[model samples]
Target: MTWETGGKSEEPDGAGRRDPAPPPVGGILWSVAGDIRVLLTLPSALTMQVAHPAVGAGVDTYSVFRTDPWGRGERSLRSAQLWVYGGEEAAEEGRRLRRLHRTIQGTDTRGRPYHALMPANYAWVHATGFPVFRHASAYLQRRPYTPAEERQLYAEWLRVGRILGIHDRDMPQTLEEFWPYYRRMLAEELELTAVADELTSVDRPVPPPDRGPLALRLPLRLLWPVLFPPIARFRRFATIGLMPPDAREAIGLPWTDAQERRLRALGRVVRVVVPLLPERLRYLPLARRARARARRPG
Candidate 1:
């Protein structure tokens, strides 16, 4: 019923197995998940995640996304970065998320009860990232990952799910199982949830960044109305455009061919531009630090 590591005894996972640790460093996930390009597709992943009824309800009710969007996003990004690059801290972050979600329970808009920790909901949230990553990679990279690379990426993603406390039973164990499961959820479970709609709405009001020094924050607030329209449009574009086509269709979001062409053009630019940046600029802060540490004499 318990497993031990680092002098700590932890409860067995949903499959009655020992805790599945984070994906190994220098693995597929390390190379993929921590890249700055992931930020471009993150909105799509978040949108897909909340399209599930329970996740949407929990987020609509308990999340501070409306009031503190920047802070909430920063924290989410930080947690994601920590999962890939934090070493021992990655498992602790996983535990922290599980603990944080324990209280996220409520009735969804359909009057059905839901909880964040419900295995299906938890697993679905973790599952969305894989497809989105693969889809977005086509545009963000010179080419999408090859079949073998996708298999490796999916395996690595499964380990990341374990780090988030998802059971092997709750999620499809391999790519063959995963696509069917993903399609079934898209057909039967996913919806245009209220939260999903709002997240993808271009007109949705978002405040200026409030994190930095007051001097800069004040000017940003004054300039935000002028600055936000294009940003909001791009956010909406990326959220809807980056989703797998099946998922977009299932949720009734439209994707025009023109938009697809534009997205590809932008992706082409990103592919050319991103790799030219130095590591400090290319990777997120945590990943950058981790790479620096790995390069040190040891």
Candidate 2:
């Protein structure tokens, strides 16, 4: 395949100082990243992200994943939506993320020093999403994206990477370059860090989701004992089941043939049902609003 700059900005920056442009309205990422269907596969993407030692270390040290898992996931999902659908807000969100991570440095379990902003670590986190979406689309999407669409999608993801402060040098610029890079990372860099283990472990201790109005919280707290087991089991299932098989093996995640069959069955239902929902229900609130604005006669 010929190398194509899918992520290159169409507009020239004369001063070479302008912030990277956000994914365009009606672009591949604008549609894919903002859809509610993405939630089905995001756990797997996140699990793959933390499989990198530096990222896992940073998350273990600084993230509230354990204590505030719901809030943490919600914020992450919202930030991702902004990157594709928040228009001008997308570039600001990216800068804000850099500022947030500026102070997040620590030593990994292996005693290697790591910083959250390290290009390789940050890029690896961004990179994991592409493959997960590609792989999981077979199950979650009504139809898997065609080869041309895949190229377009990867290119859009790279553009989003720039928004997150990742330079082109740190990420592959084309689909042809990306596959080799992705395989190399899987073969050489990724492993099951402690955070990855817990994320995919059924027995891991996860507190009841503790945010929301008191009225909502009280019932959820009371029902948590009954509600949490299925929720935890499903999280573990989705995280492992939706992961690319190569990455799953690289990270040493266990998966049975039976589980694969079940995951596929679930995906089929999601593909058929999710697309049938109306826009307000099918898309996240941020995406719903932005898509409406994009369609307005300007």
Candidate 3:
């Protein structure tokens, strides 16, 4: 995607001009992330990432991925998305992220050397994003991605990886090559880790439902405890269903007959309800802004 910004010199500190609508990581990347329920895919993505021995070891040692799991996940993902479409803000945050990971190299549980910045490790992290986008897009729309769109989506996401410093040589060049490589990694590289199990457990409280009018708040406060466990259970079940059976087994999240039944019913419910939302209401604010910016006349 050729960027054609006007001859520009106004960027602060001569940071230079960046395309507000960079094609590689725009559109589908923001659209997919904009889905409110995309949060469901987090445990699954994180589980897949940390299953790599080096990723697991690095995260366990230098990251707050466990102690402040939700906060850490939110900040890290926000940065990644910002890097894709937030222009200079993305660049600044990306640098901070690179600086943070600079010291995150050491040995894994097996005493093998590892570095978070290694192309291989960063690619492992980037690889997980594709499936998260795929599943969320599929579930929200009750539609599958066309082959062309899938490849396009992968291509776009690759630019995002590059922004975060993942090396091109370490990434699959096309969607055709990705699944096979992903499967091979699962067979050879993914392993169960205690942190992965803890993430999948999903026994924690979700964000509060309402923080507005006292009328709404009072009832939500009363009902939240009663409602949270079943909601969390369903989310856990849906996340487990997203992964292949072997991967689930590797992470020690057992799928049961009851979970399968509930998950299917939940999927049906989501398909029916989500599309009924007004298009404006269906996506996140960032997605709306990105879409609006993309459509503006050059």
Whose TM-score is greatest here?
1
Question: Which pairs of residues clash in candidate 2, taking residues 3 or more apart in a chain or in different chains?
Answer: none
Cα lDDT, all candidates: 0.83, 0.82, 0.66
| Candidate 2 structure, TM-score to reference | 0.91
Q: Rank the candidates by TM-score, best first.
A: 1, 2, 3
Kindly list the per-residue Cα lDDT of model 1 for residues 70-162, writing each as its tens digit.
878888888888778888777777776776777679898778898788888899988998999899989986687899999998998888887
Identify the runs in model 3 with alpha carbons over 4 angstroms from their true place: 1-26, 202-228, 296-298
The digit string of per-residue lDDT tens for model 3 on 1-298 reads 0000111232232145452333343456666666656666666777788888888887777666545544555565566557555755655554455556666788877778987778777788778878766765555446788888888889887777666656578898888788898888888788887556655666754554543467787777788888778877766776677665667766567888877676667767877887688867876566567667877999
Deviation of model 2 at 46, angstroms: 0.9
Residue lDDT tens for model 2, 94-163: 7667766776788976788988878888889889889998888888886788999999889888888988
| Candidate 1 RMSD to the real structure | 5.0
TM-score, prediction 1: 0.92
List residue ranges in candidate 2 displaced over 4 A. Answer: 1-16, 212-214
Candidates' TM-scores? 0.92, 0.91, 0.78
- Give the range where candidate 3 is weakest over 10 consecutive residues by summed lDDT: 1-10
Top lDDT model: 1
